[model samples]
Target: MIAARKSLDGLSAGLMLILCACWGMQQVAIKIAAPGVGTILQTGVRSLIAALLVAALMLLRGTAFFGRDATLWPGVAAGLLFALEFLCVAVGLNHTTASHMVVFLYTAPIFTVLGLHWLVPGEHLRLGQWLGILIAFGGIGLAFSAGFEEHGSTSTLIGDGLGILAGVLWAATTILIRRSSLSEAAPTKTLLYQLGVSALVVLPLAAAMGQFGAVSMTPVIWASMVFQSVVVTFASYLAWFWILRRYLASRVSVFSFLTPLFGVGFGVLLLNETVGVRFATGAALVLGGIVLVNVKRSPQPVPV
Candidate 1:
């Protein structure tokens, strides 16, 4: 692998935006198909399909998977976390607007930063970083502070809780992957583990919920599933891994702040969800704080 680049070139920046767009559209796509396919079951089945696609891509690219014995345990653990993250997403989308869910889910970086400060050497944050994290969480509180008396409030609150939980799990999964022997494994293999294990793990739960029979072969469901399995799950991830290999993490992370914005935009446009000033304020802070937390500061001038 190449040493991480210290800056983002034009092409990389463009690619980052494209990938963010892909991620942003994912929730909207799933919500569109949720009527025909039970969200939870659809997620599992979609993941199963993605696993096969990823495996085939790995072979086509001459990439080996699970080649090292040391990677297995951590891989499985990360895979389970990945499954649980999306499970929350699937469940939460049923009760809340997709816009709300995306805002909360992107809080993963804050949680991950806080966890890594003490857990990993060289991962300590400056005061500015801590300030950014607090600002982000403050936005979260503001968004949910006083809406319980409103209609559908109970479901919205529950959805918010699940979305936050999903973010936490996403953070935990990142920590597991970065801290594990899988850090040295191929990106495809790491992704394969997540998709493969998630495919297996979600099946029994889907069965218990009787979600298998919920799937209908409607055009919307088919389009959504195909998009999820092909573009977002497989192509977007491969592009992400490739971009990460070529760009500085900090720069890439800053660009990722666009994802929730895209998600919110798509949700409002596609689903016709009303956005409140509170949500708008919270999303601004969330996106702003993410940019503040991830941006690489300029180096000081050389001494005389």
Candidate 2:
């Protein structure tokens, strides 16, 4: 009963660019607020705030959460993975620059493609996609080698590894959704499951890690929380789901590669983080690979 989805248009493209910018800025926001609030606490609190907003939205939409659908197990699994992903993000950022963290995290698409190729029928990779995978890993190696050059700092390397692990977890979540009843559930429902479960998981984890007492909650930190909870987590996700419903997902996915670029830019502008020439070159390859991995080949017309 769904309408046929269309290719990306002008408005959607612009909105996607805006969305990418918001997503890119997310790491920088976390970094900015980290001085006042520990990263785990920040992530947990924001998830809690956004979960409330999403619940309110569901209430207004009259969407029932406890349906007869078989999404519960998959949803819980996805939520656990989501918690782990952000846990990596929160811990990893303590050791790496926001720019580096963003680049590494956005590698999720490559991992997702690889995972789908293995798990899902009819999702095999083409030559271009294979090339993309190789290029992206090559870039990862190049960037990771930078940590070796630092001689005394293994923390950055550890952070980068966590970032890649987060990407893998994110891909796993996507595959789980695609392979389960959550694929048919309302997008809001899926999102709420992730957010609600993440809040429950991370809050306790943060407390166990002794991350709660660090909260200083300055005006800037509060603003960062608002931006993260309201704008980035709540509004941006809803916009992304709306876009997916309306546009060709493959084409729409291609633009997501821009997120790291925007993230790097925001890190430079706001956080004053430096991007070395070596890292810049590697990030370029990673972005290029991600684009190739997501872009589908257009079919040729047969000659009469």
Candidate 3:
């Protein structure tokens, strides 16, 4: 657990950046691994592993998953929303290119900032912060708009709509976590509920969709699953919840614009995707917006 601090302190900023990077890399990894393991099923498989890991951690920490004190309604809500977010992305990608998915999925922060500001106390974004959000999102759009223009035929309105729905579900997830009783529970236990529910719900749906594709049973695949289970789901999510609790959700949400930039960076390195001047210029605007938004609140001068 992290010590108490003001919103978006140095540690919090560093942690958010790292998590954004992991999520960025994860987009590439899941795309590469999706076909063989099955897109939605792969999420379930790693979710199950992450659930087991969280369950074990819960036992050690004495955070019960099934005791009378369990937060049933909130946990279930979060899990379903979590499941829906990924399901939408997986299914949406079938109808759209990864560009559409990338652009749509990260629109989550906009929804998150709006919803949290309305619902949660101490979670409001100032006008400047809101401006930063818009600027950063615009930069993301500018950075990736080239792809949309270049391969416009590959994306469908239906697919883009589905991806937007996923972004809404993601916003719903954050709002639910903040407003629901799950917020009162330990981070690991909340994580367990989400993964357990996702494994149960998504696995059956994948089976129904005939998405249980044959596995190569390769060592590399197993390693990838292990990495997703451990790094992506377990550690990264725990860090997110911890950070969320430590800071205002709206303040934190703006920084998430970095994820797509990191995604593009890794895509260029790993997939040999070309980066044009738009990408570089957009990346600078995004980073500048992040720094602008998180600029420390001016110290109030108190006088007698």
lDDT of 3 at 133: 80
TM-score-sorted candidate list, best first: 3, 2, 1
TM-score of 3: 0.91
Winner by lDDT: 3
Better of 1 and 3 by lDDT: 3
Please write out the lDDT profile of model 1 over residues 23-119, one tens digit for every residue: 8888899889898888888778888888998899789999867465588889899889999999999999999877667767877766776676667
Q: Which candidate number has the best TM-score? A: 3
lDDT of prediction 3: 0.79
lDDT of 2 at 225: 93
After aligning candidate 3 to the native by TM-score, how far in Å is the CA of 120 from where it should be?
A: 1.1
lDDT of each: 0.74, 0.78, 0.79
TM-score of each: 0.83, 0.84, 0.91
TM-score of candidate 2 versus the correct structure, residues matched by position: 0.84
RMSD of 3: 3.9
CA deviation > 4 Å runs, candidate 2: 1-12, 132-152, 243-254, 275-304
Per-residue CA lDDT of candidate 3, range 49-79, in tens? 8898888888888766676655887898899
Weakest lDDT window of 10 consecutive positions for candidate 1: 295-304
